[model samples]
Target: MGISEMRRTGEGIDERSNFIMYHKGEVAGHRGVGFLVKLNLKSQITGFEGISDRIAAIHIHLPNHSKNWTVIQVYSPTEQATRTDIDNFYNNLTEITEKYSENNLVIMGDFNAQVGARAPGEEQIIGKYGSGKRSENGKKLVTFLLENNLTILNSVFRKKPKSKWTWLSPDGKTRNEIDYILTNKVKEFSDTGIIQNLNFNTNHRMVRSCLCESGTKKPRPKAIQMNKTQISNEIWNPITAPEDLMTVATSDIDLKEKYNKIENKLKEQTRTDITKSQQTYLSEETIKLIEDRKNLITKKDKKENQKEISNLSKQIREKIRKDRIIKRNKTLENYISKTGGTKKALKELREQGKEWITKLKDKNRPTISRNKIQNIATDYYRSIYKEQNPNQTKTQLPAKQQNIYNINKIEDIPEILESEVEKSIKSQKMEKAPGPDKITNELIRGFQVNGQNRT
Candidate 1:
């Protein structure tokens, strides 16, 4: 996982979620850090420094902005590291933060610290919404922020305790907000919180924050962000499935009706889940705003409607742009990757800029036209098939092959024990891609195996 990509591209041991990479490896490649900058932003970068394997920085001077932005990305030593290593890391960070202290600076990445809620004297650095107890490193973080005059942006925003955590412990017994974004210009922050349901490919829940500048009074950003955890808990309510939900789906008409019923049940469970959105990238939160806009279209408050519509439109566009940037990363372990894919998948990825098959060859004749090629292909396939006798009992097979059903070995396999199924589910790695049912492995792990093996 690239700690550098944690903010925009995501970080994890599996395949990276970005096409572009800016990485620095540390700790024997385990703690490799990298960034994925958009083309427009990359062009504005005045400078970048790979200070060390565990840290890096990018300097950007936005057009007409009075000050430049110096982003210092870091990955601190873990709790188990020697005290010297930890101390050295903080010392290095202190130097870098001091260097860009004058700029509109932002520091981000895995701090591996829990600052918890706001403390008595840390009103300027820490906010009331922080979660988990402050660890030793958390104290160090608080001191660092205070010394540097940086605000913990995520902490300033109210959120569910469940939605505040950035990392989930291996055993799933602990959830802590260790990853963070600290900025000297806190008033520019429009929103901040954990972005749940994102496929970050890491135990750490992705954190996101919005910044809006060019204003007189820096009012606290009131845009309440939504995440999957909050949506599923407060919005979605599952309907009970009928006992014979699948039994009556034998005929085409029966299947269609059953499918429609199930679809409606899902929609009814989440009242505003319904949407005819054109963009595949739109999230539940964005869709809800879309519904709101639709309702506003028919109201008498044209003035209010126009203002909100413009704001929603701008937000929707921004969300799409960011979501597009976040969607390009791919891991090598996946069935299909940038370097590996089936013939068809590879063809699409390669994008050779032309049709792969421009012409077809005819075997029986030396000369052939494009139209004739189609006829020849059609005739060839037609010659391979023939009408079968309607009275035939079953399909015939070669002696060695026999019939597929005749070689059945179903009875030879032992019955699967419920305990075994439970163990399998429990052992499944979280955040894995789901199977044909679209039920993720994490969700499947939550189900109970109620019975024992067949006797």
Candidate 2:
């Protein structure tokens, strides 16, 4: 779908290790708000919405947890913004947060304001360890927090005054705790502070919050799973990027660079344009049982709840095992239903067909290197062509045939018209499998243009 005509504002930014940018202006500008889920935790995301350029929300539904989480990432307007704009930002945010009141709520990112300390009425909203003098915007944020049952996590944790600030002024003389992580799960919070060791290029020091139940331990940060070669070849597509990334017709970049930019943009389009929902094997009853067991485990009276918990755990385990068997049966049934795909699926399971071979062999060559694998097929084709043209030579070709084989300039090629694009899409086989970009013929054919918008 074309983003140019998308709604300007109202929900929250969608989440993925692959990101969802909420662009505000019609033009490609620098300002926007977004968030990225961890690669391992991407499946936990239930939904997300890009309401406005300033605010967005992502929901996470983790099995066994008492409640799902709705994390709202916001970039509040600067102090220079009009009073009306500022009020609207807070009002809209409150509306969205309230909409997901059932979920364990988390509001994070740059508030662009400071909450000095706990006032008489804000005892539950903030802690005694608040950073500095609260500004006007800060008061607004605190009021929003108070009304919404959000506790400023950073305020609750003990840290030196110098260590609490997240953003530093350009002159290096001013530091403020403008950024914050506010959540209702204050009891589960382990720690909160500024992280300066990270390699981010920004004026703000990262604010991190570690949260867990009473007896739960903090998990180590997950390392991105990839080998040295993959890491070395990786491109810097940072998850935090929130700007329009459309390709520009500029001479500064080479054709390869331009091509890569366009390909990357298309890939992002394909990712966001499609619907992605996580599939769960366990049934609702089993999930509820697991959640009940978790809640029991967190109770104060362990002995009283222990027997019930054990029974619940056993039932959960049994249910999970049964679900596994059912899933396997269903998978097999699906494979059997697909006439040609069954063989392909079985081949994949056995790792016997079209598997990447590290080495190639030829009778004459004996053994071939990775780079020489292409030669095996090329040689076979070469021999067949050679056999067919035993009496022929390149110099024996006609003048017209030789001229047709000559290299031509890119500029000399006819430009593809809009009509050609429409025709090409319409001509595709709808029954065929989707391409690498996941653009199936059915999906392309489903596209409709209404007024100025492409849908």
Candidate 3:
């Protein structure tokens, strides 16, 4: 409600508002209008429009409700402002109201104006509860209400004289109703009044209203319940299918066929495990409640639904946490059983590190593109392996020293044992980076399963 000013575009200001409106494809950080909706009501918002710094709106549509509701919040200039500024405010307001005339509209904000007591010809729009005498800005506001077929909700509901005024003067002598809530459909609102007890560090008291949409039935969606016992059994039960060793030993069949048989079993087991984990962690009843809450439109309904959903969500999260801990412990037990001890496990981990580069580019060096890094590595390695002149003008060694160094080369470096190769292949880690041949360690290990070794 302070002096409104347009923010400079493209300033890269932080978006701190609960819900901010900006020009299409641009950011203006200046005086902006935003809606501070409750967490449960956030999902029901369909879209928003930012007309200017002083005006912005959000559209809400609930499931099973055919009509859309548009709530526009505005902050008008004070009465002491120039005439041109006042005219512009009304002009923008008129355009916005007409554009959404077909939909249910609720316009509420500090207009910096008043309607005073009910006038002779303004009986339909203003009620008897208005405070203080009329001012120049007050008259303009009443005219705007009459033109748009809107009624001031604050004035319609009767309240005590002290509770009727929304704004208090600095000296505590003057009080007036400068803020208001206006609606085209007045029957939807059950009551409206100033909340006297709430402590807001401002001269204006907070105004609240109750709105009820009559004849609207609250319907819940169908629930899909899963049995936790069944899920657990499916995940923990071992495969009992007999192995067809004769077919696997047939030389005519290829290695891919053998690999697929094992891969298919592993994939099926993984799928069953995932399904079990999901069913155990998230209950069907909780999911159904969340879906039902999403359809609620009114603030009161949404607030209540949010509390229920929050508790259910917390429980599901805790279940997931426990499942992860159990899985980790099971994996550790299997690793210990297979490797025999921690020393053997550590040795396997060290060999697995060979496929990845241990050193990275210097952090002090300027950042380079992926292509540039590849190019530099290729050029450096190419230079290292380049042929050089053997008889170049370099110093020659002594004959005795040369003869001593040129000892007879062994005709055969003993052939690497099959057992050693198998041990190395088994030690390779799964899902590690591939080598120059574009083959992962897991793939190399897979080849050795049928006594078939890859280079």
Candidate 4:
């Protein structure tokens, strides 16, 4: 069997019941539920000959075609007929009978075992022992009927003396009465009141209770209330009759289709519009904002670069001092090697090397005071240079050897000279264009006079 069919029947039923409850709520609770059923289905088999298989368990669906139901089919696969299955069927019958005030417990389907045989002392009787056939499977079914107190309605239908056989074998010769409908719960109906439908081509005939209407017409279950406002807006309320049920059920299918189509169209439109929006260029105001942000970033980057340059310069000076100390060590080693490796000669050499060592030590003493003035001068030059030419680079600066570089107050020089520089640039741009004026003047200063004298 496929996995779908292999799933536990109880779990499938529970999930289906939950789904129904989610969709159908406001129809008066489980109390007023009823069944609308079509049954005895075989593979693709239609009409009266709906039963084709040798044997499988039967199921009775509940009212309004929901998931919860009682089992009503007979002659399940032998392996499938466990105690649990039988007990579940009996429990559901009791549950349904108690669930609603109205008598809606319908036990209709083929039950393969006959309750009693015609001959007395040969088969099991209604009350007597050994009166029925002693088949092992048949005994279980008999016990189920007796224990549940279900009444066999077929016995009442026999009062009219209808055709005796309820099922036929394929061979046509071996026929046994097996199919039956039983119920002890519903009142106002008996075995004699049951109606057996025409043969309908299947082995078992369709049997229905006379107590049941030909067919019931009732309101469809209302969908769950999503919200009071939305539900009220979406559904016309106060549905009172079967006509209203049909009207509501029929419109939902069309509305659902319309809603799906509209959703698809909206998705397509969004995709198209998104592409156009991406290709559209930015407006001028947005461009200016971006440029301003870039400028701020540029200024920050310049400040950081200058700081790094100052650090690099300091590191270079420290490296120079370390190199001088290494050179001094090498000199001392040379002087010791030349002193003939004797202690007395070495002492004399050391005395002579004292002044050299002092000079080397002075050179490596980490000259903070001297370098501080140089650093201040460097800072002043950099500040004035950056102020005077905000956009200038070292490679782009003018090479003129100006005296301002030697001045201690170089920081104030930019403010003093900036206006004069600006005026000079403007004055040069404002000078008149260098084109010669034509004045309709003096014809073009031809070699010959206007009187037409020939040269």
Could you tell me the lDDT of residue 111 within candidate 1? 89
Give the per-residue lDDT digits (tens) of candidate 4, residues 49-97: 0111211212233333333223233333232468775565445544433
Clashing pairs for model 3 are none
Q: List all candidate RMSDs to the true structure.
A: 24.1, 25.4, 17.8, 43.7
Question: For this target, which candidate reaches the highest lDDT against the unseen true structure?
Answer: 2
TM-scores of the models, in the given order?
A: 0.45, 0.45, 0.45, 0.27
Misplaced by over 4 Å in model 2 are 1-27, 213-455
lDDT of each: 0.63, 0.64, 0.62, 0.37
Question: Distance (Å) between predicted and true CA of 185, model 4?
Answer: 3.1
Off by over 4 Å in 1: 1-20, 213-455
Clashing pairs in 1: 15-331, 17-329, 18-329
Clash pairs, model 2 backbone: 9-51, 10-51, 11-51, 12-49, 12-50, 12-51, 12-56, 12-57, 13-56, 116-132
Candidates sorted on lDDT, descending:
2, 1, 3, 4
Show where candidate 4 strays beyond 4 Å. Answer: 1-75, 78-104, 117-135, 160-162, 190-200, 212-455
Question: Which pairs, if any, clash in model 4?
Answer: 34-63, 35-63, 58-73, 123-131, 123-132, 124-131, 124-132, 156-191, 156-192
Q: How accurate is candidate 2 locally (lDDT)?
A: 0.64
